[model samples]
Target: MKTTVEQSLRAYLDDKTANGELGPGSRLPTERALVAQLDAPRSAVRRALDTLEGEGVVTRHVGRGTFLTESARAGAEAAPPDTSPVEIMQVRLVIEPPVAMLAARLATQADLDRIVECLQAGGASSTFEDFEAWDAKLHRAIAHAAHNGLLLSMFDVMNTARTLPVWGTLKRRTSTPERRGCYHQEHEAIVGALVDRDPEKAERTMRVHLEHVADNLLGRV
Candidate 1:
């Protein structure tokens, strides 16, 4: 699992223990169960368990499943490092606009198709979870469209940050029909610039979109 994903799972598990949902010696959820429950990949769950075991937060037994160690239950109240929404937005502002520019210049037809597909799917979503998944896909497609390996890797890191539980909590609280509608328009504008092969317009539109999202998340603009 990526470091960000591990941290996210660790934070969530710590919360569960702190809330008295799982006591010392209690068996943790199966890897498959954690994957489904956290909407995470199997690799992430496995890695998180590995990290927990290393931290003395969990114990893995062959064929018996993983269990929370006694120390974990007692130490679970300690919070993980903070990742504020503002900081996330600041990072996006630095990286994504240029990515949009490069993507506009470089995107293949297939990349455009995939990005459009994600947009359409998101627009059709009836629930926030479904919408959020498509939203992430859309951004990822754009990042891939940039066609730079390093940029793609950096974008993956940002995307991982988005997977933090706090990100979801803030998104769910801030998302509304009006904001969603605005986002749809903003997304379309960004894609429209890309379809036109207008790098400058694409970059500008993407930055605007990111700023709009930040504002919505912060209850500003």
Candidate 2:
């Protein structure tokens, strides 16, 4: 029984092979290694390899390692896809909106105070790198104030996704004076809404804040 996990493993391996990194007769890392690297189950890795051999993308000779077919080599050279803006937003969509909702309901006065402090730090930042770090920390503190373990975990995942090269490109292209003013205004609006204990207003304000980020940062939302 092939699971979706197995299919995903197979697809990822195929993609790597297509990029010309896994050449003809290349013996890939062992199943245990892949399982460790992918953080997937042993059965999933074995199943993917079996399916690949069956389809002749790779061949399994008796007592020998798997060998990539010529077609596999040609397929392997597809440039590794750069992560897309939509993918980045999908991550934020999962983590942030709900965190804002939770922060509205759960944040304490001290939590709000801490977030305000972080925002002030961001404002005081003179360099882009420093400001970006504080800006991320401010948002992360808001996520922390949400008081849900799952929300915190999701924020970590989204933060990892945000580190991609496309994000770097967007950061470079955006950030003019008017845009910076609008950003500060929205940040203050969200903080104020949370302080007001207005969950609906907080959520709405947060939605606007993130929408502006998508418009200004990625240009695709």
- lDDT per residue, candidate 2, 1-221, as tens digits? 55465456656666776686776677777667778877788976665565444333455555666666544433333213465767767667656766877898899887898789867876776655555555666677788789876656556555544445577567756866566657778888888888888788878888888877887765657
Model 1 regions more than 4 Å off: 1-81, 219-221
Which predicted model would earn the best lDDT? 1
Candidate 1 weakest lDDT stretch, 10 residues:
72-81
Candidate 2 lDDT score relative to the true structure? 0.67
Error of 1 at 185 (Å): 0.9
TM-score of each: 0.65, 0.60
What CA RMSD would you report for each candidate? 11.1, 15.7
**Whole-model lDDT values for every prediction:** 0.77, 0.67
Q: Relative to the unseen true structure, what is the C-alpha lDDT of residue 3 in candidate 2, on a scale of 0 to 100?
A: 43
